[model samples]
Target: MPGPVSNDQFFARVGELLEENKKAGHGSVFFTQKRLTPSNVQNAEDKDPLWDVNLPGPFAVLIRATNGKSKENRDDKIKVSTVVQPESSEEFFKQYADVCKAGMQALKPKDRSKRKKKKAKKRKGPVDGEKKP
Candidate 1:
């Protein structure tokens, strides 16, 4: 989770994911947008992704959780994206790490100085050779 990410996008992805999972039976997820949309964005699904991992060309890495419904074993998953899914898990992790790192670098500290730029300065004595107020 990055600081300044879109709340709408986050919720949208989660909603689409749950919808896909619902459609795929027990615990599965499916793509909801075109295999390839310009800008890699779409109405609901493509705008955000669960795990980009490695999406070379018209591809994305979606996951399907298929574990015995229990509290302690929910991380189990199946790679669902196929168009350009990573060939190896190593690649998946690598891409995730990359996205996280980029997000971290993109964050910036908020500066209040910019918003409070109009500080009143004292008025100078009436002007050239004029009497003081």
Candidate 2:
């Protein structure tokens, strides 16, 4: 008899695939667990490995470009799409690395100073409120 596949194994497989697509020059990639459908929930007792816990059926991954562009401008920009599928650990990792690389490229850090300025402004008392003596 075959041993049951562990949850870690399943998650790792998905992560690996996303990473590969990122490295291949895609903008970004992410993995999410498949949700139970209304039909599945209605019929559920114990979790169904085929339909509930595993990767589920087909899904799409959207990778935005690194350059920040308005929605209209971005429409013309190239984006990457990944299709999820059953894959061995090794193959999955390859794909995951690619996706991760693209994600890294697309990520942009927020301006910390802008946030600090907003917080400081909020902390100020109203005009003619109280004065430090």
Candidate 3:
């Protein structure tokens, strides 16, 4: 028996699965969390999914877990966003990647020199001692 799958392996497998499903014309498939809602809390069988995915629709399906549980698992950070739900996994990933890219950009240091140059250009009014009417 194998030990445990690393995060790299899990993410790689997820990519492969998405590609396979797309190539097979099964529409988009996404791996996302299914948070327990108040209505589902009382259902004994409606326990939070360890792993869940939706294919081409809002209906979610569970993926069997191999690692059982981990001490490093981030359950709290897995809250599903109720804001917008993409129709397909491809759409979901596209939106997710775009947000991640934007976040990365935000973390980058800004160039004050560039901003100053832009401001200088904007400050140029009428040029060569010409007055604005």
Write down the lDDT of every candidate, Cα atoms only: 0.40, 0.45, 0.42
Per-residue alpha-carbon lDDT of candidate 1 for residues 1-133, written as tens digits (9 for 90 to 100): 2232232343344454555555555563332323433464434546566544444454443332222334555454322222224344456456534533443332466777755553322234235336643
lDDT over C-alpha atoms for residue 131 of model 2:
66
Identify the superior model by lDDT, candidate 1 or candidate 2.
2
How well does candidate 2 score on lDDT at residue 112?
98
Name every residue pair that clashes in candidate 1: none
Q: Candidate 1: which stretches are off by over 4 Å?
A: 1-4, 28-133
How many clashing pairs per prediction, in order? 0, 24, 0
Residue pairs in candidate 3 whose N, alpha carbon or C atoms collide under 3 angstroms = none
Task: State the lDDT of candidate 3 residue by residue for 58-125, as single tens digits.
Answer: 54322222222236753412211222233444554565465434433324576699889888877785
Ordered list by TM-score, greatest first: 2, 3, 1
Candidate 1: Cα lDDT at 127: 50
Better of 2 and 3 by TM-score: 2
On lDDT, the candidate that comes out on top is 2
Q: Determine which window of 10 residues in candidate 1 has minimal summed lDDT.
A: 1-10
What tens-digit string does per-residue lDDT give for candidate 2 at 1-133? Answer: 2232343454444455445555666534333333224343444445664554454543323222223234787753332223334444356556556645544544676669998888777777553255653
62 Cα displacement, candidate 2 (Å): 21
Candidate 3 deviation (Cα RMSD): 15.8
